[model samples]
Target: MREKLQLIMKHLRQGSLQKMWKQTIWIYQYGRRYWKSMILYTLLGVMGSCVSLASSLISKDLVDIITGHQTGRLLSTFAAMIGFAIANLLVSQASGYASTFISLKVDSEIKNDIFAKMLVTDWESLTEYHTGDLVTRWSSDASNISSGILNWVPNLIIYTFRFISALAVVLYYDPTFALFALLGIPFSALMSRPLLRRMRNNNQKSAAMNAKMYGFNQEAFSNIQTIKAFDLIHFYTDRLKTLQKDYISMRLEFQRMSILTSVLMSIVGFIVSYSCYGWGIYRVWSNAISYGTMTMFLSLSGTLTSSVNSLTSLIPSAISLTISAGRLMDIVEMPQEDYSQDHAVKLFEKQHKTSGIGLTMKDLSYTYHSGTEVFAHASMEAYPHEIIALVGPSGEGKTTMLRLILSLLRAQSGEFQICAGSDHNQKLNMSPSTRKLFSYVPQGNTMFSGTIAENMRNVKPDATDEEIIEALKLSCAWDFVEKLPNGIQSVVKERGGGFSEGQAQRLSISRALLRKSPILLLDEATSALDVATERKVLKNIMQDTYPRTCIVTTHRPTVLNICTRVYAIRDKRCEVLNEVEIEKMVKEF
Candidate 1:
């Protein structure tokens, strides 16, 4: 079982190697933008390593010179060593500055790219990931990548060079001393295997706990009002505590393993140094090696042992960094939907004579993931210049049909088409740009913390003041908007905190209207409004606006009364009411 565990740990460590190379290449690509700075930094690092090696060699020479009473040579060597030390310090500082600058630049670039990708991803796919998870990946995971660039890259290079150079110098003085120092390599390798396994397991648990904690916080903040209304704060708080406990336990276990590894590696270092010292002294006493040579060999052996130990200590962190890089690469390498085809065309055409595109569904069907069918072989059509009302008992697929028409969800089997013009010659599948042909106001009047004008600009970025005012008038919102202290420029809190539900609904309508899309879809748009406000808004939308295709999904009598045609959805089928029947139904409602 232990061997199997060791094998699993080895595989896990190796798994991240490919990702590390990829991340290294990405950092190199980023460094290309500041090649001059990168070159200077690399040169300085090399110089620093050389200075360190020179210092060690100089120490040995000074000891030998003192033993022989050569004061002049000893003083000259001490002065040269001091000057090299200063140069090393200056170069190391400059390299740090350069590394930090490069890291910041690369972090910004990666973050921006990730955010842009999130924006353009398919809505369904994007919704599968929690908002906080994405945020953590973009921020924390990218930070790991940046650290690999700034610290790991340069340090790995310098340490590897120093280790090899130190080993070479020791071996030149006495090959036996160098071999003794090298014995630590296998001991380090043995200790690292189990420690790395423990670390990997702990890291996985810690990451899972973090994701859970972040998810809990995100949901809690987004629905604080509901949590308070329902008095569920303690429930969420307890859950958060559980996650925190798990994270802490995992971190403690990881630290314990690290400490154990460090202690074992230190023991190995001491053994190697003692063995080398004992053998060197015996050789000196036997006159097999001079005292001065023995001293130089001892100094070089100590430096080599330290370098080997440092390299061994870095292995665990390097493994962790590689694992983080693999996670980041998973996101960066996700296969995006192909949107680069010549055949791909916008869903709407300006030359279409129809005021709005007409939708037709022929034998449409859909099912949720749990194998529950929402609709099966249902069909319906809505034309331009009319308002279609969809009414049904709750849980009978009213919203599902609307989503199918909007292309937010695809039909499992059947044909749905948007005939672009009155002649019905132009038909196209929905694309990203085509989604712009319709304006949608969902069940909630969601708003951001921004000025009213800024919210309007979300629908139409370049909308003129006159156009915005006209849209507000059409939505019966201009009166309240004008009453605001700053009119269109008035600041609104998140979700329109200062406005009543009815007022927020009207603001959402005004924003949608500003888009001037041919098709308008209102899914329970006025459900938050009083009877009087609902009547006024419905009247303006149906009577005052120019002929356009409008679909409203609601059970409200006010909406049913104003719609030009009413359709009842029952048993996954749509049935249009006769004119007299519709009028009678409207009158009764």
Candidate 2:
């Protein structure tokens, strides 16, 4: 026991106490919003405890009345007991129902707020966390915070009130009996310090294990087709078994420690109960108290002991809550995307709705957070009604250029903007807000589980069937789409299942075309299509009446002929391709 205290002092000296207090304060902020509901729940619990206390005292009076034949007060005492019992039962039920309602409400509201924050978080900053880890923190950690916020504070108040009141009753009846009831309190307090340190550590490990399993499952299910193709069914199953074994082993270790702690506490509780029992019977034999008094003493003694145990149990719960809050805080407090120029971008879109916007970059420079340079002093321009091509060997800056244009990544230095015309005075700087001015068709099968029409409408939710079909025809996807029984409404499974790669690419292009944005950036979006189809898609985009500026990055040479001009990314700069250079590139392709 002295060693535990020494360790606690050691922990305090190391400044862990301050860190723990900060985490506690962080969690308390969430609980502060639902003050009214928490107060109501606490009141109900206190009311139930008062009624229960009254019931015990009333029964004592009823017992004495029966034994002494006091017929005058018999009916009244009996009626009071029954009424208090029923009221206590009702309050308990009401409190339980309110708990569930408030818990779910708090959980959903916190999740909704945090989910929105996650979407607006800076893209580069957010990529530091894995998808699975983020989901776990957003879901499991958020739920823990809510449950703790709703229940922990109120339960602490309720249990403490019950304990103090019950102790008062027992002490007033006989102080010696109260001492016997408290025999377990000191021993229970001693056990808690060690258990708290272990509980907090175990919770962190458990949470990590859960996230690892969730991530593995999500990745496996996402690549189930590949797993089947490679005949890795048994290998994945064995891997899952290994993870399960590690999870089970971790849980069992914690459980064993918990079981041991409970056993020791229980033994102490038993000793205390018997001591109160022995002392009460002895007092009754000496005629110092009546049978009714002895019965009431036993009842209050049990209550006092239980309340002590309940109070001790809260420490572990508090520790767990603090850990959960810290995990969620790490994610929610990241740098959010800056939308300071959103209104400006919106105004630009409104003014140039018909004329369309032109992308302009001058002396542009960018380096990743890891210090890898993508573009340095690179400049490019794409005017409305022109198809511009970006060509480079693999590992070059082609895709990186598109990301910079989309403002998914920020440039370390230099200028990026969009304008209505040649006049630089009418230009707006690129930012998260500028994303609304452009439509992007990135590489890969980026389809969600939905129908063909639903996928197209993801970009323009109010798009009509006529608009969807027109966009599809431009990408040559309407030919296959029309063959389906449901046409545009036909179901498209996850990752564009039930369709060829080329067909999916065409459908993606169709969705992008439907957006009607002024600028269209295709980052290897047509790689899966045939040379003729790719050329046709580029031509269709270039000829659109909406004055769309198309920029495409590709390895193929066929689409270069249709481009107004081409740029090759080399040595961290965009090198303009002349007629000779363009012809040489086409021949090389």
**lDDT, each prediction:** 0.72, 0.88
TM-score between model 2 and native:
0.95
lDDT of 1 by residue, 139-250 (tens): 7776765665555555666667877887788777777777776778788667766767666566556655676678778888888999999999899889878878877887
Where model 2 places Cα greater than 4 Å from the true spot, the runs are 1-9, 12-14, 69-72, 422-424
Instruction: Evaluate model 2: give its lDDT.
Output: 0.88
* Candidate 1 pairs with clashing backbones: none
TM-score of each: 0.83, 0.95
lDDT by residue for model 2 (239-329), tens: 9999999999999999999899988988887898788778888998887776777788889888888888888989988888888888887
Q: Which candidate is the best by lDDT?
A: 2
TM-score, model 1 to reference: 0.83
RMSD of each candidate relative to the true structure: 4.5, 2.1
Best-fitting candidate, scored by TM-score:
2
State residue 158's C-alpha deviation in candidate 2, in Å: 0.9
Worst 10 residues of 2 by lDDT: 64-73
